[model samples]
Target chain A: MRIVASALVLSIPILTAAEAARGETLTVTLSHHQVRITSTYTGAELAVFGVIGRDGATAPRSGDYDLVVTARGPRANTVLREKRPFGPVWLNDAQVKFYDLPVTMAVLSSRPLDEIADVDLRRRYAVGLDTTRASNIAPPGAAVREEEFREALIRLKTQSNLYVQDERGVSFIAENVFRATVPLPATAPPGAYEVEAALFRGGVRLAVTQTSFEVTKTGLEQFLAREARERGLLYGAAASALALVFGWLATVVFRRD
Target chain B: MEFYLPIAEMPVHVGLVLAMSAAVGFISGMFGIGGGFLMTPLLIFIGIPPAVAVASVAPQIAAASTTGVLAHWRRRALDLRLGLVLLAGGVVGTLLGVLFFNAMRRVGRLEPIITLSYAALLGTIGGFMLVESVRAVLRARNGAVVDPRRRPRPRWFGLPFRMRFPQSKVHMSVIPPLAVAAAVGFVGAVLGIGGGFLVVPALIYLFRIPTAVVVGTSLFQILFTAIAATLFHAATNHSVDLILAMLLMFGGVFGAQFGAQAGKSLKGDSFRLLLALILLATAARFVLDMVVEPREPFSIMLSEVLP
Candidate 1:
């Protein structure tokens, strides 16, 4: 309560004391812009900080505000396969291909998304898991029963903690200041991650802001991954040579026998 | 401790990898072969991508065979001429194997084909070895002469381009050894194995090579073929994980030394019987996996499908 009172007092800049709230905007920042994945990287938690700014003389809102934070990783093509029993063995029978699906995604909101906004608004804004699924773009001539495959994909990703949703992941520390926490798993690929913060009041979106961060490999992890991808023949030969050395070293150690 | 594999892009427990490889190494050492056939399947079971598992095991197989190859070289127990001839054909076969592997992977049927192949090949070999070893055991129990080395040569032994293998004390067409090694090498590359088991039997029974040089010659060929396969997989598939291979090699080499010591006490017929049973058990496991319905019938192929 003290923090909210202080925030209100601080916003009274006096220049437009009688003006109605107008040109409301969100100022967003992140705890870290560069996430480095090293050999010991298990996971990381990122913090999103934002402030709701409006005209200096804007009147106080009539109701509490809502915030939703969404983070999405780099996109890639994905395939979902279904197996069926054939003769005495299970075989891959059906498959669906989704183009440019985010490798990792999470939706965090101050309250249940449905309470904050209606279904059409949430779907239009792609604010939650269901909306995210709806946003997926499948190739033309995709398999029938694609909803089953899409649901399965989301389920599997959720099981692996790749796709996440939390109803109470964001909280307003001050009346106009909010913070959201995004947890990143070790399996998160290295790429640009987009973070979107949206502000709402009375089920109406007031302001939206966007920011991005990068996940990158560092040190030995980066070096090895680069070599394997760019210098395949050399890396392979080196691996074979290393194995031979280990074998020879073993023989020498056991030669006395 | 856990370490991340760059190529496979996953984390694996170091202790688990070492323990699994050591156990497979022990079995391979006791049987005088590279243990890739066992290690590759075990790797996939532990959640490593099948393509990465198959490619990385190639280096491990080469390393395991190096021990036998060097020992045989030092003792002058292997036929260099025959080994080179087999290796020449093995190179051609390895190339074809890599091509086939890439084609199957693109079609997304690589895992099923690999599983089916292992089941059929292991089952047949195990069945044959079981009957032969059981007969040998019974003959020894009855105090009968156990030697069964004398056998008639095949009709194709007289094919053109004959070569005299002075060390093996046999004169046969080079075509036979070349063809046999090519087939074994093809299977070895595709399955990420050393093919020592296949080669040793072919040399002894099909080519009528003396048992004295069979193991050494087989190891010589396997070492080169595995190296070739490793190179091909690394260059073409880009799936070989050097870190994973190194971890496997460290555990396998150390375990092999201890296994060789333990093997000295077992009788030859008992050893053969034990190996046959192990092979049969492995084959049965693959068959069971294929026939049983998976709890989750839907699986995601975590690869670039469009790009």
Candidate 2:
């Protein structure tokens, strides 16, 4: 399942429409369009190959090019909780709801994100772990400590391997060709993931393009998950019956009578 | 080997899960009890979601109880009438427990509530068992016999709806057994235990059920209650991972046979003492977790309001 998506260079932020019309265009080819998760599925490395093409009027650059490939999983609502000391114990005290949170996110770049772009630019483009934004739906009259929660969310996600970063994952193979390896951990949630590639030179964005892939459960994993979600009652009954059979069989096999 | 759990949405080391279940199963088999009290927490500790851990263990508990239930039924050691009454109350309790579990999850307080409940229940029950077993051991050493017939009846014995259990040769108010079973069922459903440890003592001491039928009757109730709990968890929470449960059931059933063989050599009081210590140790672990400042003060969860 190779999916090669070539995009016409689009003007994004600093890049002008006229410049994008004649400047570099980004084309990306994914090793797999769909990652199927079976019982034995562990983790996968998705190879992203890209070519930087220039139109006739485009000027050649003296310096090398920088590429960043980011893959963001499906958005979901998330809760962040902070534990506070209470009566000799700590418990979850404060919480904030974050809407449209990415279940899994990975950043694969030619260089450290900080070196590629300044903090403000990175934040604007969502080029790194800290730059990804998930809006908090604060309750009315509540003063939300959003920065702390956001940092905590990123930290937790990183710990779980759901959020990842590879500073030198992208490598230039030729003058106009580059490749990036997106490491998807086994814990990555199954859903549609948007993969974006951005081309930069001397801290100035030249082009941006996006592609999509899906992570899906296959075979028994697919069947069971679907049954559990769609026919919960029947799934539960089946589980009980299965357990009973196991129990009965155990007794029979071990029977000393 | 690693296996991905669909409902849990995580990959677990197959060997680790199996060994854990086997260890817990061995203890349960040695003590003639359901091992869910130990299993759910272990699953959570190994990074399975708390709700998933609790729900998935329900079927495992049912499977573990089945062997005892069948054996007791064949021997006619179980009081079917009493077991029915307990199951009736247990069904109600399991329903309420599932509803409460859902509500707690929505509020993001499910983890705290489950931890607190385990600490409290395990601590109290373990302490009682420890003291009783110690006294029993001392009495045995002194060659003293405690007469059960001379024991004073509790005040609650006068409650309404008296019923006769011919197998156990006991006549008592049905309300007591109903209340006890309901409490056990509610705790079991929420905690993912069969509640055999709690039921055995309550039936023996509270209702004066004969020791001969107590284990059999309690196993009967536990088996059905666990079935109900498993059904509710699967249907409502959708957190029961069938693969994980299957692993647990296989390990538990296989390990129990070996454990039963070893248990035959230990004296009853000493065995009870060992079981009590295990319970206390588990309770202490929960307490320690609660009181200790976590390395990471913040946690994240999927919000109930999914987009």
Candidate 3:
């Protein structure tokens, strides 16, 4: 009986030690939960702050930690077209449709994505814009190369300030803590956005923490958008009437004596 | 002077936009046409998206046409009977135009198609107008009374459905006027213009309507066509930016007042010559854009996913 009791005590410490090495814990805080788009809305900056610790401990060692932060807008289907010379004129030669792609994406990492993760890992996690390919569907019998279209899509998105990648965008302020600031351009579509902070150790994912926020129109913009989507006929009628009235008023005001 | 455009979701310099609209409006007022051809391209160049630029300019065309119509009404220059027939054809053309526009948009080919068509159409029309106006100016300088009515008639003038337009004192087949107006309306809807520039010339040269009646009749038809265009854009594409339209109309109306006063100072031949030159210049720019290789050869557009 005594031997059995000693065995139980020995196994308890071993189990606790195993649990300690199981995974890291992550917590995230954002500057704002909702972005209000008003008349003067040009663009906005969001500061994402997070901390990583192992098994509920206060802080993890600096050398053992690597962080990657990504912020992505709502997923939507997108079509990318490539223009090529057809005879003497330029025409749309090829197109690729990407399903469930983020309209805007920003990736920030402690180091370059290739340096931090292997090809499979990067592809799985979509660590960089180049590595991200979410179900690109091409037309049947299209002779165009898929890789060329995908690269062109990324290039176009980057030029529009929609897809961004910064090798050193994330910085460690102290051991186990990191922060990043993402800039959303004026052209960013209004929708829900997800911000993810992933903790890694030696090229392996430890833990991932996620938070979400919303971007929405307000005031006159909100009313106009609702009218357009919901009561389209009424909106059209009103717009036409307003135009007519303005035209008549202008004529009357500027009429010669 | 920056003002936020709620619908466009961007901030623009109030002074710059107002001045630009005013300048275009002045030209429209002097020409007695909707300035949409100039307005849409200029708006796009100033960073407005092509869809939004095309849709938003419809209301401005409506407003400018209304002003022109009122002025012509005061002068008793409109042929109401002829205007009605042109508008009847315009309605059908606009409906078809909107459908074609949406189909092109579905294939993500709207921008390039619009640009290419603009280049071709503007080049042809501007070239013809330049030659005609230059000849008119030279004839006036030589003190020769060149009567437009004495010009050789087109072969198609003898087609069926002959009708009498008493106001302009002409008897011709109705098909030519209707077909011409329909063609102009189609281009107008696609390009976000009032079709006034095209319609005015067709009335004067093709249908041989008097110059005095042509401007008023063109304005009358454009007012209705623009109204249809505004409704179609709003209901179908939801792309009509009311804030942008209102700002442009505000400047356009005021500028038309000054343009009318300025028109009084210039001779008819000189005025036509100046307009022709401007048209040629605008068309040249479009041609240059088409022939030149773009820096970026790829474009991104939103795709409609099956629900």
Candidate 4:
């Protein structure tokens, strides 16, 4: 309650400041900035609320307000491979290397992205799933049909629920206030995520705002990840010893009288 | 009911994982075999990544094999000298296998190679088991008796470095047994199995070990091989998921006990027939997967970020 109240308080000042400046601006506030992963963690739904403050003189019709929100997980290199028939068996044939691709991505828009902005603008802002693929480059010397590989990556990621785009995800709660829910799947890796919200008028981007949050493992997950990465040899030895002890214990406890 | 696995980075139903492991454990206990051939595929079918599934299953096999070894030890069904020879060969073979595994992964050929190898290996082994067991069953029904002493001598008997195995009643070159053990260990490391099914048959037919000691000695070797595999996979690939292994082992330990008790009442021929059917079924599944069209032809893997 206190966090929400404080966020609302902070949002008001930004809203009034934008009105005084007589220009279009966006102010975004997230419900929570830190997501903790625990033993019981399945998934999480994060609420993103923002206000699009615009000068009264340039205010569009009530129904013309457009807001698009995008959340991207940490960037990393990825390999995408396609299996093709070889003789009688299928083998991986075509491969593509993508650099600096977001591990997870979620895009939410009040309306269809095409209706809000043109193709060029959408591509520039990565406002839609199709446009997001345009930014990924194929590795040199690889005969990678960029279009096919990019589509495959999108399809696979979408099936895993790591990449999502919802046309009606964002909703206008008031004339200038909007909110959207971003669903993070259980398979999402821990990382820093950047949430970007953009405001547009007449197919022109007016103002954009970005905020970041962190997803971190806690408790057993934290300890295990740390051990596996930092002290790998020790972790392996401990794991083997634990298994040995457990097996011995089970034999002792379950022995027939 | 669901628990998040840290290394696998996924949430799986506790009951589902336990039930699957228990089923595999029961089969392993009844047959005196390590259950990785069944368990690894089941784990992949249930949405765990194949790499993670393969690596994590090693520790579970180690635990189950230890229990099996203890039980056999109590019955005095073990030949320590022969087992040590196999273990020495197994350690060397596993090191080579781990290097091969890492190399295949680096070239992005690991998934396809692993799948194809499973299909080929399972198909041949299952086919042989099914045929041999059926022949044994038929011969028993017909009351045909054959004297073991009259059988033709194996050609490998003339090799150098002769060693006597008093428990198995065999006097032969150590080269054949060591070579067989090394080959089985290599496959075991690559396939994430204890190789008990393979080793048991090799001991009985190749080394001509007594049937009583074969199971115990195979388990003893498997325990060490599995431990080596788990450590190598963790140190090199960091693919060993301890939480997943523990969950599987938790159910396996109890399940093996019950399975062992139940196996006492089963007839030998019928037991062999049942195991043969299971092996065939698992092999058939892999063959079908290879021949059939996949729903998605493409897969994505995150590459490590260079420092």
Best by lDDT: 2
For candidate 1, the TM-score of chain A alone versus the native chain A is 0.86
Stretches off by above 4 angstroms in model 2 are: A1-21, A139-144, B30-32, B95-122, B145-166, B187-194, B208-212, B258-266, B303-307
* Consecutive 10-residue window with the lowest summed lDDT within model 2 chain A: A8-17
What is the clash tally of candidate 2? 0
DockQ of model 3 vs. true complex: 0.35
i-RMS for every candidate (Å) is: 2.1, 1.9, 2.7, 2.0
Worst 10 residues of 1 chain B by lDDT: B298-307
The candidates' DockQ values read: 0.49, 0.57, 0.35, 0.57
Between candidates 1 and 3, name the one with more favorable lDDT: 1
Off by over 4 Å in 3: A1-23, A55-60, A140-144, B1-13, B92-125, B150-175, B186-194, B210-212, B278-286, B304-307
Q: For model 1, how does the per-residue alpha-carbon lDDT over A116-192 read when each residue is reduced to its tens digit?
A: 99999998888888776533444454445777788888888898888999999988777777788888877777889
Q: Each prediction's Cα RMSD?
A: 5.0, 4.6, 8.7, 3.4
Q: What share of the true interface contacts does candidate 3 keep?
A: 0.61
What is the C-alpha lDDT profile of model 2 across A80-172, one tens digit per residue?
Answer: 877889888899787788888888889999988888889999988989998878778654433357777888889889988889998988888
Error of 4 at A135 (Å): 6.1
For residues A1-257, write the lDDT of model 4, one tens digit per residue.
01222344245446443754767778888878898889998978788888877676764565777889999887778889777886666776667877778888999999899989999989887887877653454556445478888888888889889899998999987887888888888888888989999888679888888998888999999999889878877888987897788778777887774
Looking at model 4, the pairs that clash are none
Instruction: Point out the worst 10-residue segment of candidate 3 chain A by lDDT.
Output: A1-10
**Segments in model 1 whose C-alpha atoms lie over 4 Å from true places:** A1-24, A54-63, A133-142, B75-77, B97-118, B151-171, B189-194, B204-213, B261-266, B305-307
After TM-score superposition, what is the CA distance of residue A250 in candidate 2 from its true location, in Å?
Answer: 0.4
Q: Chain A TM-scores, one per candidate?
A: 0.86, 0.88, 0.86, 0.90
Among residues 3 or more apart in sequence or in different chains, the pairs in candidate 1 whose N, CA or C atoms overlap within 3 Å are none
